[model samples]
Each structure stands twice: as C-alpha cells, then as structure tokens.
Target: MTYDLYIGDRMFSSWSLRGWLMFERFGIPARTQPVGLYSGTMKQDLEPLAPARLVPVMRTPEGTVIGDTLAMAETLAERHPDAGFWPVDPEARALARWLVAEMHSGFTALRGDCPMQLHSGYTDFTPSDAVCADLARIEELWSLARTRHGPEGPWLFGAYSLADVFYAPVAARIAGYGLPVGDRAAAYVARHLADPAFRRWRALGLTKSYDPMPYAMAVTHGPWPGPAPRKARAVDTGPSENTACPFSGKPVADFLELDGRVFGFCNPACRDKTVNDPEAWPAFMALL
Candidate 1:
C-alpha cells in the first residue's frame, strides 16, 4: 500500500508535510518524491509527478488522486478512521473538520503577507489589515479551542487530531514570521512546537532541507526559540525526516517530551508499544 507523495522542502512544505505525516500515521507506506515549489521548474516538474500545480498531491493504491491540504486530510480520515486521524467525539470531529476547512478556504491575507519559508530569520513586518484580521480570528479560535479542550490534552482538541494537522502550518507561519499572537495563541504555538511530530519537523528544518517557499526559507531562528543543541545535531534522521515523521507521523501525546526530544516515556507501556520495535519506530522517526 505504497502512496506516492509530492512535496517541497522541509522548511517550506507545510502542505506536503501534513499529507505525508497523515500518510505515515496511518501506516500507508509511501514513496516520497520532492517537487521544488517556486523553483520555476515546478509546473513542468509536477506534470509527471502530480500533474497538479500543488506539491502535496497524493496518489493512493486504489489509483485515486487527492490534492489540497484539507481534501487530502479528509480523504485519509474517511479511509483510515482506524488510524484515528479524526477526533472521536462527534462534536469535536465536526469542529475539527470545520477548522481544517476554514484554514483551507480562508486566511488569504496571512497566506499572502506571510508566505511559508525557513531561510535566514524574521524581520518586523506588518501584516495588512486583512492578514491581521485573519490572525486575530485564528488566535480567537485557538483561545476558544484551547480553553475548551485544554483540560483533556494540550492540542487544539484534548488529543492530537486532524484539526492540529491542518492548522500546523499556521503555527509555523506565526513562528517564522514572528507574528504577535498575544498570550494564549503564543502558548498554543509552544505546545505545537513540543509535539513530537513538530519537534522532529523543526529539528530537520534547522539543518538540512526546509520549505523553500520564500516565507518558509526566510526562517532564521528555526521553530524553537533557544539555540539548537550543538550535540543534538548528531542525530541524522535523514534529509527526508522533515518532510514526514520518523515515528508515526502523529506521535502519541505520551511519546513526546514537552520539548519533543523523544526522551523516555511516562511509563513502561509506551516503551513496549513504540520502543520495542526498532523498525516501527524508524518509519515515523525517519520522517522527523
């Protein structure tokens, strides 16, 4: 059940990262092929790989083709419910779907003003009124969602679910661009950064491949605020780690540290499930 995923660099390919991460989380083995966006060769490059002008196009074993972030995530959600891609609660799941949909269809201002990248660093750039409005709304959503779900888990919902996946790019954009999220949203971003999937994503972006989209590549501090560990650099997960996940793309809440270093787990149960199988761990770990 290998899937063919088209993606951009780690620092820049939030779209591709989401799709690939979902693919990995569900255990849908995939052959990853990078397509350089904004490379001028993208159109011609994708003709053979994806045929669409997007990077995160996924071709499934059933020969079905899906593109766009929400669509791809939903498609997987429908087909891989056993993966728990969506939240379990009917209401939570519905709200999750709504948020992902909104992120896909809306936020024109932020998308335009803060393009995705991870190159140098951030500058004090002002968002247009429209982008600011989008940010404000996003922050509000986070605040509300966090307030409601915080008691259960740290993610947008109590546990990590599809909603988090879709909005992850927004967190990255805010981090890379140094946007003012006030308090609640800023805290939300920190939690996201500590998520195993995100930490892996950030670590990879620091050294090797990053999303090359102008905004994504412009990232100077990487996602984490402190300097990346000089010794931590030795873990060569691989050039492709950032593009997907190394463990399950959706690292369970228990497996990750607050800083997302993949240190020891809370107890022995996790060690048996995720640690015993080296091969299993590497799949998701490789992506990190």
Candidate 2:
C-alpha cells in the first residue's frame, strides 16, 4: 500500500528531510504532499491530519497517521522488515538507535544557531561556545560508530541506515553554515551532499523561491562545496534561453554559458554565484 508523506519546504525544513529520507533511501513507495511551512499555511495544511501540528507527518494506507520522526522511523521499520532500516548486527543496531534518539532529543544549540539551508555556504558565520560543544559531541558519536561498525563504507554503520537519514540535516547544517568540523565529519557531510537523492531534493527545492529568503544572514555567502560544476564558457550576448531567473523568477538581467547553452539570472549576483559554482545550485545544473 502506498503511503502519503507530508513535507515542508525542502530548503529549510530539517525534520521534513529526515522523514522523507526514511522512505526515499529505502525504496519505499510513497507520495508526498507539501505543507506550507514558511507561507504561514502549515496549520491549515495539517488540518486533515488533526492533532499532528507539524510538517513531515505521514499517513499509512490504512489511514493511520504518524507525526513524530522517531515514531515514523519505528513504524516504517516495523512495516518493512526487509528494508534494512537498521543495522543487521545487534550491537550496531543498538548504537544506531542511540544516535538517532540523541539526534531527536539533544543538540539544541547547533540546531538553533545553524538551521539547515541548501542554498550556499556562509563564509563569516562563527559558532558560539555551545555550538562548538555540540559539534564535538556529534563528532565523538560519529567516530565511535565508524570505528566500531563502519569499517567498510562511508556511512556511519558501513551501509546506510536510519542514523544517516536522521543526520542528513546535520550534514546540511555543517555545509550550509561552513561550521568548523573535523576532517572525518567534514567528509561525512560531503558524502551526504554528493548523494543523488540529496541532490534531487535540493534541486526541487531550488525550483521555488521565497519572497524574503529564510535564514537570511548578513554574513558573506560563498559557493557550496560538493560536486564540481562543468567548465563554463563566457558569453557576450544576453540570456539566450529562459527569460526568468531560476532563483527569483524575475526577468533575466544577466547570463552565463555552461557546456554550450547560455542560462539567465535575475541579477549579476545570481549570475556570478552560479558562475562561481554551477553545480551548487542544482536548478542551474538541471538547466545545463
């Protein structure tokens, strides 16, 4: 039976990403419904699933509604016994559960100071003492998982599991905010960024633009680190293709060519940002 998953904007909703990955990474069949988190329609959007006042709520085929991410994880694991949502080894599985539970209930400082944003990296943002402590704790947990259980693969438990799903947003936060992390932690974050599923989610998120960008920072934003963009060729002419900016949907005022086709942007800032790194903005990558 097909499940209905309700999610918020992909760009900023950390919890929503975790919920989606629970099904998406495991190949579970489900259809997604968007809840208006930033548009102030979240309450109305969640009205059908009464008592669940948050995004990333799921509805089972039998009409059972699940709200909390932890509950959703347990329910999915129970329903799909063959999905391998947890590690096969009992000890590893126990550690995985511990990681996910800690992620669910702790790390308030990092979560509050650095919200997940799939847009670009902040160059000047500095983490407070509490955030630094949280990062240290996260790295410690990651190291333990990798040393004991993840001897084979890039994932924490060798193969991907619910631990990775839950931490995906944490990875996004590390990348998006340019948080100072250990090399190992940085590599794990990079792995998440390079995942095709994560890329697709970020690409779809880029298709929609916010009026006032969420998590707007006064600090300088640099190009995001991940897959490198194709070498672009400078174009003398104006936009040769789309008339509207992929980011803001405004009229095209600037242009850059990648591979061969010229793409347009609403302003020089958008154009230059894309030019600096095209693949960072997956919507632009789609255009190329």
Candidate 3:
C-alpha cells in the first residue's frame, strides 16, 4: 500500500527532508503532496489532516494520519521491520534512537541561526557561540555512533538508518552556511552531499526559483558543495542517443539538450523534471 506524504518546500523544509528520507531511503512507496509553506496556504492545505499543522505529515495507507516525524519513524519501523530503519544491533539501535530524539528536540540554536538551504553555500556566514555549542554536541553524537557501529560504512550505523535521515538537513546546514567543523564531521557532511538521493532532492529543489529567497542573508554566496547539475535546454528534435525513454521505456515525446547532447522523455512532466537538473536522474545519467 502506498502512503500519502504531505510536505513543504524541499529547499527550506528541514523536517520535510527527514520525513521524506524515512520513506525514500527505506524503499517505502509514498505519494508526496506539497503544502504551500511560504505561499500562506499551509493551514488550508493541511486542513484535511486536521491538527497536523506542520509540514511532513504522513497519511498511512490505512487512512491514519501521523503528524510528528518521530511518530512516523516509529510507526513505519513497526510496520516494516525488515526495512532496517533502525540498526540491527540492540546497542547500536538504542544509540540511534537517542540521536534521532536529540535531533528532534535539541539543536535549536543551530536550527535557528542556520536554516537549511540547498541552492548555494554562504561564504561569509558566521556561527554564534550557541550555534558552535550545538555543533559540538552534534559532532560528539555523530562521532560516538560512527566509531561504535559505523566503522565500515559512511553512515552513522554502517548503513543508512533513521539517524542519517534525521541529520541529512544538519549536513545541509553545515555545508550551506560554511559552518566550521572538524575533518571527521566535514567528511560526514561531504558524504551526505555525495549521496544520490540527497543530490536528487537538491536538484529538484533548484528547479523552482524564489523571489527574495527564503532565509536570505547578506553574506556572499558560492557554488554548492557538490557536483554541479548539467544545464538543460529544450530542443525541437528527438533524442540524439536513446530511442526510448530512460524511465518508462516509452516512445519519446519531449526532448531536452544538455552539454550539446539531446535526451528524450515519454512526457512533458518527465522532460521538465530532467530539464531542470539533468544529473539528478541516475537512469538519464547512465545514458551518458
């Protein structure tokens, strides 16, 4: 059964990222709906899921509405035990839970000072003493998790878990604001930036442009901290490479040009998604 996930703008909604990662990383099927967080339609949009006045609300397949990210995580874990949302080892699992809880309840200073934004990095941004303290606590928890259970893999538990899902936006905050972190912490942030899912999310977010962009700061901006997306342009001709759509194997209906190469999609929707960020799609990238 597919779930209905209500979320806000991907570029600025930190909690939405956590909720999305819980489903996306775990292979859960969810149909996501956008709530206008900035356009002032959030209340009306979320009215159907009454009392859930926040972004990242989840409506289960059975018609149960869940509001909080923690509740959603636990419910999904209970429903899909084999998905490995939590660590397999009992001790590691406990630590992961603690980390997720802390992330949900703490880190107010960092969250307030450095709102998550994926478009570009701020070169001139500076962290306050409170923000620094929050970063230190985060590093301590991350270090403990990685050293104890994630010695092999790049994730906190040696594999993707709820901890990584919860902290994905924190990584974005560190990278976007150019927050000072130790080598180990910096490397962890780099890992998140390099992740395919994370890249795709950021790419999708970049598709929409904001006027007077949310969380706008006077600081100088630089290129995002990861691989840049290929610029896509529309062309009247069909794909120069593949005859079939990369996603559905359907006949090409729309075309996009990237780096002097043309790509065909089954529909305008698919074409538009790729045109905004050609590198986000693994299937399309594999064609190169």
Candidate 4:
C-alpha cells in the first residue's frame, strides 16, 4: 500500500524536501514522482492531481488526493500512529504542532531572500533588517521548543518530529546563505545538515541538471561547509581554478558536464544560458 508522492526539483524545492522527510524519516514507504518545476511543466504535471497546483502533492494508498504540507502531515500521522510522526507526550506534541504551524505561515523575508539552495553557501551576503528579524523569531521558536524538551536529545521535543521536518529546509537556507544565527540555531542547522536523510536527498538532487538556477544570488561567500558525502560523489565538485565561468565569473569547480567535456558555471542558471544558446557562449564553444 505504497502512497504516491509528487515533488519538484529536489535541489531547489524546499517544501518538497519537507514533504518527503515526513514520510522518509518516519519509515512510511512512498513512491515519488518528480514534477517538472524548472522545466515550465509544473502546471501540466499537476493535472493528474487537480486542484493541487504545487509540488509535494500526495495521493494516499486509498487514492485520496492531498495537497498542502500541513494536511499531508496530519493525514500521514493519523494513518501511521505507530510510526511516531508526532511526539509521545501530549505537551510536546502540542508544542511541535505550534512550531510546525509557525514555520508554515511565517518567515516570509528569509524565504524570499534565501530560498533553500543546497548547491552552495553565499559568502558575506548581508541580510536586510527584515531578514534579521525573521531569523530572530525562528531562533526564539527553536529555543522555546528545545528548552522545554531538548534535554533528552539534539532534536526539538527530545525526539524527531514534524517540527524538525518542517524547519529542515529553513535550517538549510540559514546554513546555505551563511546567515547570522545564534549558537543554538547554528547547532540546529548543523544537526540538520548531518542527517543522513538530508544528505541523501541533496545527493540525489544534484544528479540532475538545472536550467536557469532558481534564486541565483550575487557575491557568494563560498561553498557551503562540509565535504561532499560519499553518496553524492557524482554531483560533488572539486576545488576552483584560476579560470571562472565566463557567464557568471564563478570558480571553475562549479561546472556542468555536457557531452565529453565540462563547462564552468556560477550556477545552474548560467549553465543553462550556455546550453540554450551555445553559439553565443564562446567560453563553452572553446571547450569543444
């Protein structure tokens, strides 16, 4: 009785990752279908699940269509009570729900500026006042949850819950953008990064090519911390060289492989530029 899960590009789709984790972390087996998020087929791809015009849409084993992460989370939790999707304690469960709801509704500024990009971290990208305020609120929410229930473990509520799953992408954005966050927040981000499931999600996403990278930022600080996990070797990059991608002037390490040769790009967007119009790109042309 495997459920069908529809998601977008794993690398850039933050909510998609959140939906996937709700199932993966809890041992709920699901079959995933990748909807074309960047390929401009998102609307067409979602026709099968009408009224669900977004990624992370799901169809239950009984063929009930569910949209939105919150509804999906609740349905999954109800169906698999033994899986422990929520915390055991009543208080902790309520708090977890609060945190997840807040995350779903709040943090507009942070999401706008730093969309979850596991590709690399931005260097010295300063946050606006609004963004800082959002980060502080997030820290406050995380701290409250931890103070009440984290004595037992690294996760909020003392054990992994939907709260962690919901905020996982926010943590990724914070780490990816090198945003200023408190030690507790940083630790939380580190924990999320170290999760095997997250690493696998990122690794699998990197295997695909991105055309017109989403939310390409200027003035990148550097690649996000941590060496590429062994599983993501196929997508992991090497050190940068003196030469840069002509399109975005990013280091050589962030290159795309096409044909038998490699082409340097600052981000997938830049790479797609070359791919779409090879004659216009001398740098890529020279590689031939």
* Top lDDT model: 3
Overall local distance difference test of candidate 1 = 0.63
- Tens digits of per-residue lDDT, candidate 1, 1-288, equal 667887776667778778767765456678877776756777876886455778788887877777787777878778777888877878777777778888888898898778765443375556678888999999877776666654555778887777888787788778767788787677777666555556554444544432433543332453244223222212213222133233333333333322235433333333333332222334434433
Name model 2 segments beyond 4 Å from true. 229-288
Number of the candidate with higher lDDT, 2 or 3: 3
Candidate 4, residues 45-161, lDDT tens digits: the string is: 999899999889999999999999999999999998899899998998999999999999989999998888888878788999999999999999899999998766689877888
Screening candidate 4 with a backbone cut-off below 3 angstroms (N, C-alpha, C), the clashing residue pairs are 121-224, 122-221, 123-220, 123-221, 213-269
RMSD of 3: 1.7
lDDT, candidate 2, 52-151, per-residue tens: 9987999999999999899999999999988999999999999999999999999999999998888888989999999999999999999999999997
**Per-prediction TM-score:** 0.71, 0.82, 0.94, 0.79
- Cα displacement (Å) at residue 35, model 4: 0.5
In model 3, what are the clashing residue pairs, if there are any? none
Question: Residue 54 of candidate 4: its Cα lDDT?
Answer: 88
What lDDT would each prediction earn against the true structure?
Answer: 0.63, 0.88, 0.90, 0.80
In model 1, which runs have C-alpha deviations exceeding 4 angstroms?
A: 25-27, 49-51, 119-123, 205-227, 230-288
